[model samples]
Target: MIEVQGLTKQYRSVRAVDDLSFEVKPGKVTGFLGPNGAGKSTTMRMIVGLDEPTAGSALIHGTPYSKLKNPLRTIGCLLDAKAVHPNRSAAAHLKWMAQSNGIATSRVKEVLELVGLSDVAKKKAGGFSLGMGQRLGLASALLGDPEILILDEPVNGLDPEGIRWVRSLVRALAAEGRSVLISSHLLSEMALTADHLVVIGRGKLIADQPTYEFVKEHSASNVLVRTDFVPEFSQALENENVEFTSTHDEEGREQLLIRDQTTDYVGNLAYSVGVPLTELTLKRASLEDAFMDLTSDSVQYHAEALPGEDSDAS
Candidate 1:
C-alpha cells in the first residue's frame, strides 16, 4: 500500500498540497483525480522523492521513497512517457533502466512483449508515435516488476484499442494484488477502470471512496418519463401532487424530470391511472457529474462559457 500523511507542499504563498492524506491499497486499481494545478503532480512528485514536501511524508510501504535501497522494485511510475532519451531504441531504454535498478536484462524482452512493443523494440523512441512511446514507458515501469504502479494519463495518446489495452493491463495488474494508482481525465474510462477514487481539489481531499458509492452519493435522482399521453400522465402526476418539471427532449418529446423519484413509483402511478408510457429512464449521475459537483468550490481556475451557454455549469 501507498500511504500519505499530511502531505503538504508550498511555493512561496501558494500551498500546492495541503495536509492531504489518503491510501492506495493493493489488489485494486485506484484512480487519482484532480483538476489542473490541483497539486496532483506535486503530490506524486513528493511520493517519488522528485520534489521535497514542505511538511508531512509519503510512504511506499513502510519507508519513504528516498530511503529505499531499490526504489524501482517497490514502486513503478510513469509520470511522463516521453521523458526518455529520443535517440535510444525501446529495448535499449528499458535496458538502461534495468541496469540502474540492478534488474535482470532479460526482463526487458518480457516487458516489451507485455506492452506489445516487441515488434518495434529496435525503433528509436524519437520516431515512435505518442501511443508507442506510452507503451515503451509502460515497459520500463514493468521491467522492475514493482508492487506499486503510479501512472499519469496512461491513455493520453491512445486510440480506442490502445485505451482498452491499458484498461485491461491495469486490471490484470490489480488482480495480481499489485497496488495501482492511475490519474487520467478520461472520466468514462476511469469509471470502467478504477475500483476506487481519490479526488482532490485545490490541494485538499474532496472525496475518497469506492467508485459506485461516490457516484451514487452525488448522482441526481431524476426519473425521466416520456409518453404520448402527455396530458393524461401530467394530470395523474398533478392529481398526486408529485414534484416534477417539464421539458422537451431533443426529439421534441415531452419529458418530465422528476426528482427524488424512482422509476417504479412513476411507472406504477401511470399504470394505476391507465396512462400508457413510451419511455422511462432513470438518469444516473456519471463520474464526471460527481467530480464537477464535489469539486466546484475547490476549483482554483474557471473557464468562461460561450454565449448562450450555461454559465452556472462550472
Candidate 2:
C-alpha cells in the first residue's frame, strides 16, 4: 500500500499540494483525478521523491521513497512517457534502467513482449509514435515487477485497442495483489478501470471513495417521465414535495425530471393519480458528469461560450 500523509508542496507564493492525505491499497486500482493545474502532477512528483515537499511525507509500505534501497522494486511510476533518451533503442533504454536497479537483463525481453514492443525493441525511441512511447514507458515501470504502480495519463495517445489493453493489464496486475494508482482525463475509461478514486480540487482532497459511490454522490441522478397528462402529474409531484424540473422533449412531449425519487415511486405515483405515462426512464450520471459538477469551482481555465451557445454551459 502507498500512503500520502499531509503531503504538501510550495512554489513561491503558490501551494501546489496542500496537506493531501490518502492511501492506495493493494488489489485495487485507484484513480487520481483533478482538473488542470490542480496539483496532480506536483503531488505525484512529491510521492516518488522527484520534488521535495514543503511538508509531510509520502510512504511506500511504511518507508519514504528517498530512504528506499531499491525504490523501483517497491514502486513503479510512469509520470512522463517522453522522459526517455531519444537516441537509445527501446530495448537499450530498458536495459539501462534494469542495470541501475540491479534487475536481471532477461526481464527486459519479458517486459518488452508484455507491452507488445518486442517487435520494435530495436527501434530508436525518438522515432516511436506517441502510443509506442507510452508502451515503452509502461515497460520501464513493469521492469522491476514492482508491487505499486503510478501511471499518469497512460492512455493519452492510445487507440481504442491499445486503450482496452491498458485497462485489462492494470486490472490484471491489481488482481494479482498489486496496488495501482492511475491518473487520466479519460473519465469513461477511469469509471471502468478504477475501483476507487482520489479527487482533488485546488490542491486539497475533495473526494476519496469507491468509484460508484463517488459518481452517485457527486452527480445528480433523476427519473425522467413523459406523460400525456403532464398537468396532473406535475401537481401530484408538487404535493409530495419531491424536487423536479420540467422540460419538453424533442417531440414537444412534456417531461418531468424527478429527483431524489426512484422509477418505482414515479411509476406508482402516476398510477395512483390516474395519469397515463408515455415513458419512464432512469438517467444516472456518468463519471464525466460527476467530475465536471464537482470540479466546477476548481477548474483553472474556462472557455468562453461559442456564438449562439449558452454562457452558463461554457
Pick by lDDT: which candidate is best? 2
Model 1's alpha-carbon lDDT is 0.91
lDDT values for all models: 0.91, 0.93
Across 117-204, the per-residue lDDT of candidate 2 in tens digits comes to 9999999999999999999999999999999999999998999999999999999999999999999999999999999999999899
Give the true-structure RMSD of model 1: 1.5
Clashing pairs in 1: none
Put down candidate 1 lDDT per residue, 60-103, tens digits, no spaces: 89799989877788899998998989999998998988899889
> Stretches of candidate 1 above 4 Å error?
238-241
Please give the RMSD to the true structure for each candidate, in Å.
Answer: 1.5, 1.4
